[model samples]
Target: MKKVVVTGVGIVSPLGIGKQANWDGVTSGRSGIGPISLFEPDEGLITKFAGEIPEFDATHWLSKPEARRYDRFLHVALAAGLEAVEDSGLVIDDSNAQRVATILGVGLGGMPFLEETIGQRIATRKLRRVSPFFIPGLIANMAPGLLSIYTGARGESWTATSACASANHAIGASLRALRSGACDVALTGGAEAVVCHTTIAGFNAMKALSTRNDDPATASRPFDSGRDGFVLGEGAAVLVLETEEHAQARGATVYAEVAGFGATADAHHITAPRPDGDGAVQAMSMALQDGGLAREQVGYINAHGTSTPANDKMETAAIRTLFGDHAERLAVSSTKSMTGHLLGAAAAVEAVFSVMALQQGILPPTINQFASDPECDLDYIPHQARKAEVEVALSNSLGFGGTNAAVAFRSAR
Candidate 1:
């Protein structure tokens, strides 16, 4: 099997626009969640706050015409993907364009666009009034399709849609492509922009979002007794991945090795994780076994702590089941407590944080830890960041439909 490595990463998160900005925010325990300013909430809407990138202007990264044609999701995807390629310093010219792949994960694409178009069509009572770009603009696969056209990389281009676990699946597929010699380089991650009426209303109906409109910053209290629900977040992230030999031949700087990936289905529930956390335990165990790592070697875990009662307790139980005595020693944290939940893009951004943690020897903090939940007992690196040497890190993403995925990374040094 070919050794895969992560050469570059790009982030368009609520924390900030770029990688450095997000790092600073997480390390400083700053929360990016706030009031919902994108649209005025109706009187009946329960959750009015979200982790939105209010300062993100599409014109800054895309031309006016291009910005006008696509949805917000595509704009963020292209921006992050281009930034990743530029960071990697990998020239995709005629010599190696065919060996590069673009793959991304997206859960709900262009909900705002769909809502607007449907409204306009209903109001006018004319189906032909819809814009020609409506279908292409809202489809999930267009993210990677447009990226391939923009970067001129033709190896394989596609999108993975698995709800919240979408990004981890995309990264896992990229690992397979590199290992099988299908592609020497891959731009893989996830993008999502669903901070709109339909998404909010749907989640609100399901009671899946936090209703702490008064204090939005402290709403995402993962593993805390006061945690009500998760805060919806919007963003995109891209990681430049390549085989070890291919990266070394080009002298690209390696941040961490893409050691292994593991995915499983709970076969238990639609939205709720198994109470015993059997599926999560299996996913993490498989990830460690695939990476040839001992359970004790994993120093950090970026948990799938969504600030929900069921998820937090289940994930904690899963960790305890998998690592046993070593679970207490692990430095665990949930960046979601600060950045909110970015839906499908959550795992990708978490993966970037995990890599950064390995490189900098600093553990990002899980803020808003007011009161702890006894069932969810762990270090959690609460309230403030901690400086520590971490040799191996694991990022876990558990999504809807009982999907669970984990990706492991090792320090390049």
Candidate 2:
């Protein structure tokens, strides 16, 4: 199998825009969660805070006409995708366009679009009230389709939707495609901008969001004793992937090598993880086995610590079950503590942080750890960042429907 390496990464998260800003914000233990500004939360809504991108304006990233044609999710995806291609210095001309692929992961493609269209339809009480771009703008596949059109990459373009595990599944598929000689370069990641009314109301109905309206910054306290639930976030991130040989030929700077990927299903529950964490345990183990990576070689883990009672506890159990004694020594941290939960885009953003950790030899901190939970005991690197040289790292993402996926990375230095 050909070795796949990450040449460039682009990110626009609650923390900040681009890689450097996000790296600085996360490593400094800053929290990006704040009060919900996108929409007015009614009195009945339990959660009012979220990790919203305050400075994001779609017109700044896309042309006025293009911005009006697509949804916010597509705008963010194209922003990150263009940045990744520029950062990687990978030219996709007529000769090499067929060997490049564009794949993105999106959970709820355009919830705001649907909500707006429905509102207009109801207000006008007319079938022809909806815009013609309604169907094309809101579909999940259009994210990758627009990205391919913008970047001129003609190999394969599609979107992967697996709820919160969507990004990891897309990345895993890209790795397999590259190894199988299907594409020489892949523009892959995840994007989501569903912090609108309907999405928020839906998660609120499930009681899956935090209600710490008094202190929004500290609401997403993953692994904390006082944690209530995850704080929803919105963001997008893209990684430019190329085989080791291809990257070296182009003189591209390699950030890290994507060593392996593993995916599994619990077949247990729709919204809750299995109590035994059987799916998560097997997923991590398979990532190691697939990469031929020894258990002890993994020094850091970007955990899927959702700040929810069920997820944090189950993920901790899964780690202990898989690594046993080695789990104690691993520097486990959750960037979600600061970025809130980016849903489908969470794994892609975490993957970028994992690569930055390997490159800079510094572990990003999981902030707001005032009180510790006994069941979630681990070296979370709380309160502040830790400087350490890690040779290998893994990023885990567990979603609803008992779907779990993990991707392992090896430091290129």
lDDT of each: 0.92, 0.91
**lDDT: which candidate is best?**
1
For candidate 2, write residues 240-358 as lDDT tens digits: 99989999998999999999999999999999999999999999998888888998999999999999999999999999999999998999999999998988889999999999999
Q: Write the per-residue lDDT of candidate 1 for residues 291-410, one digit (tens) a residue.
A: 898999999999999999899999999999999999989999999998999988999899999999998889999999999889989999999999998889999999999999999999
**Clash pairs for candidate 1:** none
Worst 10 residues of 2 by lDDT: 120-129
Off by over 4 Å in 1: none
Task: Please give the lDDT score for candidate 2.
Answer: 0.91
Instruction: Write down the RMSD of all candidates, one decimal each.
Output: 0.9, 1.0
Question: Which pairs of residues collide in model 2?
Answer: none
